[model samples]
Target chain A: MSMLKITDLNVYYGSIHAVKGVSFEVEEGEIVTLIGANGAGKSTTLNTVAGLLRPRSGSIEFEGKSLVGVPAHKMVSRGIALCPEGRRIFQDMTVRENLEMGAFTRTEEESLEMRKRVYESFPRLKERRTQAGGTLSGGEQQMLAMGRALMSKPKLMMLDEPSMGLAPILVQEIFDIIKELNAQGTTILLVEQNASMALSIANRAYVLETGRVSMSGDANELLHDERVRKAYLGG
Target chain B: MGFLTNLINGVSLGSVYAIIALGYTMVYGIAKMLNFAHGDVIMVGGYICFVCMNNLGLPVAVAILLSIVGCTCLGMVVERAAYKPLREAPSLAVLITAIGVSYFLQNSALLIWGADPKVFKSVVDLPSLKFFEGQLVVGPINIVTALTCVLIMVSLTLFTSRTKMGKAMRACSEDKGAAQLMGINVNTTISMVFAIGSGLAAIAGVLLCSTYPTLMPTTGSLPGIKAFTAAVIGGIGSIPGAALGGVLLGIIEIFAKAYIGTQLADAIVFGVLIVMLLIRPAGLLGKEIHEKV
Candidate 1:
């Protein structure tokens, strides 16, 4: 069984159909990228999977347990965490406090261990542990967001626009960190507008457009495809 | 002689205001709700203690405990019924709901306790102690009030900083949606915030009643206003800030009344507020975070 699976997931924002019967799955310890333009329902799909939005119709099964009505916090306890878009770190809280909040569901000792692990992954965060999250630079804030999500000690992690608003150098570093995290046995589900970068690291990838999965296959295969080259890869 | 006595008086009075201010800070921190009904909750607490002592022949300690419990439940109910439904509603609606709830509680207390003011007997079985050549006398009520406020504040600080539930509350304060995503029950956390805040308010009420020995339908209004001012003065969502603001306000009130006269105290308080607003809009302890567009 896959670590995470979505079957005919449909979501709505009042009258607008934001995710129309989308389906995908992530096996354990693999990177899956969902590439799309703005308004392609990329965020909606991620939000639904994270249990932030209740899907209007569809089934989300994580490790064989249905997640249709399960709340977002319960999803975290089930070893799934969402590093939401825009790096929504708690602005008023210190970096350490924001990270601590991620492990709020776990026991004290485990959470402390997780915090140590997160700090190890981003040593810069350790240095700025006492600094308010809002005070960090854009790249640092992104690292904080990822570090915070990892503090949950999840089996599957979903990231939305990890490279948005970052410098090119920081973007490469961020992607490198993502790969390192994935290599360390964390299953990843990423949504990105940077199709080239996402496809480069992703083991498998899907192309989404206007609330539907327009294409899916091996990341390398999609990268070489003619239509994908022009529309996504900037070839 | 007058200055020293006033200083002591201010610190004691400040302690009472600090107790009341905790409710405002806690509720505002977690739920981001101003909770205008908090003052009335204090009044309700006093009435409960009074009834338990006078009508039911309960001991003062039991009456205080029962009153705290009752006020905690009252705070919870207000959060659920008055604020929960309007969680996503506009600020105006919630503000109006708060006012309505405050009025409803005040009227209910009037109906139950009548329009009479009742004196609360001192729980501390000791006389006043004098300091500085009889200029400063430390009364039992004042000492008790300060001690109780410090105890509650310390526990509250420990709860927020060290305990799991307290961290959850802080998370909710920082970001409600994200806290909910972390599997913390948002509603339950909110209820806990209200309970703690209102419970503190009840303590303040009991303390004030012991000192002033008076209870009326609108007993909580003046103290409530003072506490709200303190919350703003110290930074609304900062816990330690509220306590500092309360103490500062208390001292100012005492000295202004002692040196200048009681009439000048209100003017001086507002003047200080204006200066604070001009200097730091976020209050003394609050750090501002700007959003990137």
Candidate 2:
């Protein structure tokens, strides 16, 4: 049932070992969240799986196929998409153009269809379809990023810090959207610093600390765990 | 020649500059590197066209097509060999390599074609136009160059703004990582840009030599610099900007020569550029980098 799997992922930036022996899995139709503090390997692990970062030593498998050494651009065509840490939308490009770019590997007809579907899910993006990406508000930018990722029609979508800078209201809106997406049969791998919100929506959770998996369990069970409550949920 | 005649000549010259500037602007916008060697590609194109038409006895249209194809390949090879390995290296390194490539192209031409100048045959086989008791004249090359520039500009704008590949190119220019996330191959897009730019260089070369009627190892250097200046004037990364800059620069150079001392014309042209930049640092159509805080 595992749609995505990673084992012993080790990533380094020059001499700094960022992600060391970080392993995890995302089963089909499940919301798997990785929760951790600053400098934790959460983003690093997500990027490694997304094929953006070269692992020092590890293996990444998607639907039973090896994903290691695959370039980031090739990952989307393989049914894996990463909505990166920042809402790194092409600022000068129109919303429609940004979405079109998301489906780069798809045929013209398929991309147009995907664009219509994305617009339906994010009506606000459709409203500003011709507007430049940089002009959108933070919440709208987040929606555009998520919608842009969906344009690829990936089997598993990985999000890194999607709620990082959003207001509480916008954070709630984004989480709702994520849940809505998962409910529609899309598998989600979410890496978040906001432990409580991520745990609430996630089916399962993994806790990373200083480049390793410190703890992990059923999302609800970890939510009640005393140590997790003390460290992440603010006691 | 009347004022109308002078204006047409300026516009014709500017058309060639605009075409060359498009190559500079497109590559700079997407790859974020000033392809200094882009100008030398023009010289290479000119030589290729000359060989095909003169030695092989090919027709004008076929010679130009062959030249474009050859330049496109050269651009890709240059990018792969010189620029690709240094993609992650500093911009300065890439720029130095481009200068090296420029010199290499120049020397290669000198060695192959010899340093002796070749009298370039005008590609414009059409008739020239005359008006107002034959006081004002428009050379066939002028009409051809202007139309070609306009056509190229319109198509390039449409291609970038409307097509999927064009959108991918814009995305890569903005953010390579995000573009990659969207399944766009950044390397391939960069290669495509070089291809387009160099192909344009070929057309510009033929048009340039046709108007000037002289071909040498350094035929493309002055015009290349002027086109680069044109690209800067219109805003380095903007497509329309390059066209505007090229035409404006061409007019200024022509007017300066006619009205001012012929010796001071180049100075006046450069002086206008200085004054223009001081007035609008981002160039005529360039967006100021002042991000909204």
Candidate 3:
């Protein structure tokens, strides 16, 4: 059963139709990936789903409730969180403060428990809890991003380009973290440029090209498909 | 005797400036845009409170509370009408709009309240408290002003450090887009910052009126400029920095008037800004941001 659904979603940036009638869905506890090169509306699609960008038209439903017109803060309250691209952590804030901010809408009791769970997931965050988030290494920041999202206790987590600009080893570590997060029953909607790693971890994948979904299928089939092979998989 | 008296005067005046400066700092911290109209909002608050107490014969406490609420709502209106539309626009455009709003508020006050100076009667009448054989005497007004400033400062610190909204404001200041993605209502946070900052300025206006007993429509403008200088001195986006900067600027101005002739005081105060900026471009506490590329 689908936990998240998007239908004919159109988002515009003042006459620039960024996402043109794009649609997809993520089943509960499933890892779904959206793969595209730069400017393919991958990030735009994720942002629209996260309610950061109000759709120009179309519907976004999370667990049968329409998420359209809901503000970003309301989205978090209703169990949706986005780890946006560029790892935009609060630079002046301490590591602990960054995580605490994720639980901004939660009750005090839930926040405390969530903090402990986040610390356990990323022990390095615990070690550097006092340090400013900007001071963390690239790999540490990616972990911090994932941990911060986990603090919100969102049922559907959207990660945008988590592997971008990281070393190969750190990229593998981030992918492994995504898999682990899914294993723990969190529904994932990931947008990535790394098709190989994304498809490897994803249960299903969509191929976006120039503001529309060009193709989509089970992860293994798309990984083996001829067109997806030449265009995205670097065959 | 003169030295002690001047010190008291400096601190009292500085406390007022510090309150106003906090408004500038808070707005700049979160929005990264100077709400040029912020000082005029204080003037509006003062005029409203003055009319409430003096014109309508309302009780002083009631008048003050209404003025605060009035200022808060006015601030939210400014955010909604002026700042909100320009959120994604260029910084310069928002700044120009802020200046335009400031001018509009001041002129409207001038037309409504007139250009004449009006007296702001003291809310409470208590005799001075003396210390050291009367060498050091603090009046009830001065004591209240100092204590109120300290109390507000402490509360502001606690709010920024301990509260969830405060944390979100700080995060938004650091990176607005990221804060939005984190589920913070960036628009609401910015509006809250404007309200809190304007509220602080309103308190300062009331306190200033009480101390001086007279207020003009444009009274908040000069102090606003001086407070802006204080904000720049301590750091544009730093709260503790603004307070420290304000007190230091006040002391310097006082001493310049006392020891160095009043004529040179203004020159010296401005000269200090030039020297400080040359030495530390980021102001006293503002962090210097590095280019990613």
Distance from true position, residue A232, model 1, in Å? 1.8
Chain B TM, every candidate:
0.96, 0.98, 0.95
Write the residue-wise lDDT of candidate 2 on A62-164 in tens digits.
9999999999999999999899998899999988888888888899899899999888889999999999999999999999999999988988999999998
Stretches off by above 4 angstroms in model 3 are B56-59, B129-138
Checking candidate 2 for backbone clashes, the offending pairs are none
DockQ of each: 0.65, 0.90, 0.70
Candidate 2: Cα lDDT at B170: 90
Q: What is the lDDT of residue B85 in candidate 1?
A: 95
Which stretches of candidate 2 lie above 4 Å from their native place? B291-293
Superior candidate under TM-score, 1 versus 2 = 2
Estimate the TM-score of every prediction. Answer: 0.94, 0.98, 0.93
True contacts kept of each: 0.67, 0.94, 0.73
Better of 2 and 3 by DockQ: 2
Interface RMSD of each: 1.4, 0.7, 1.2
Consecutive 10-residue window with the lowest summed lDDT within model 1 chain B: B284-293
lDDT of 1: 0.88
User: How much is the lDDT of residue B93 in candidate 2?
Assistant: 97
Better of 2 and 3 by TM-score: 2
